[model samples]
Target: MKILFVCLGNICRSPVLEAVLRAHAEKAGLDWEIASCGTGDWHLGHGADPRSRASAQRRGYSLAAHRARQLCAADFRRYDWLLAADRSNLAEIVRRRPADATARVALALAHAGLPQPLDVPDPYYGNAEGFEAVVDLAEAIARAIVARDAE
Candidate 1:
């Protein structure tokens, strides 16, 4: 299965989600392809934010090699699942979706059975704690996806 995680900037939430999901999938012995992107191209080619990376590192996940990139039309055709961090990101991705693509797009948090499918708050303008929260949410959702893939 191919999964793509997406966020607003790709430097914080999406990259972290990609790393977490990759680790979980590997541990579960699932043959899955995982990647991430952003709805906007503002941070294209940039490494994840320092705080975001630090937060993920604390949780035993690495975002060091992740570079920001924008969601593209081909992505809809390339991935089996398109997991967005929030509603806005989901909306942006849906707006660009190709009619014939078979990819299933939805919020990652919702896949995890989150009570509220709200936006995964952007940590770019926040502090370390904010980044940590993002990591926590990402980890939860990643695990959920891994579990579902197992079945």
Candidate 2:
């Protein structure tokens, strides 16, 4: 499976999700392709946020090689899944979706079976605790994705 995680700026949530999910996918011995990008280009070519990197590092996931990029039209056809961090970004992704695009787009949290108001809350403006929370959600979503693939 090929997957892409999307966020507003690509420095926090999406990259975290990409790393966590990549680790989980590897552990499950799945030959999956995974990547991440932002709906906005503000952080393009920048590394993952320090806080996000530190959080994932503590959990044994590396964000060292992550570089932010903006979502492009080609992404719609390249990934099997295009997961958004929140509703706003998801809306942007949907609006940019091409008619022939094949990716299954959805909120990362809801796709993980989380309840209403599904969103992988942005940790940009928050503190360490917020980044930690993103890690928690990333792990859960990663596990869920692995399980679903197993099925």
Clashing pairs in 1: none
- TM accuracy, model 1: 0.95
Candidate-wise lDDT, in order: 0.88, 0.93
Question: What is the Å distance of residue 48 in model 2 from its true position?
Answer: 0.4
As a whole number from 0 to 100, the lDDT of residue 58 in candidate 2 is 98
| lDDT per residue (tens digit) for residues 101-139 in model 1 | 889998888866775647788888878889999988888
Winning model by lDDT: 2
* Clash count of each predicted structure: 0, 0
Error of 1 at 35 (Å): 0.5
The digit string of per-residue lDDT tens for model 2 on 24-140 reads 999998989999999998888999999999999999999999999999989999999999999999999999999999999999988877755488888899889999999999999
Q: Which residue pairs does candidate 2 place in steric collision? A: none
Q: Please give the TM-score that candidate 2 achieves against the real structure.
A: 0.97
Give the CA lDDT, 0 to 100, for residue 34 in model 1.
95
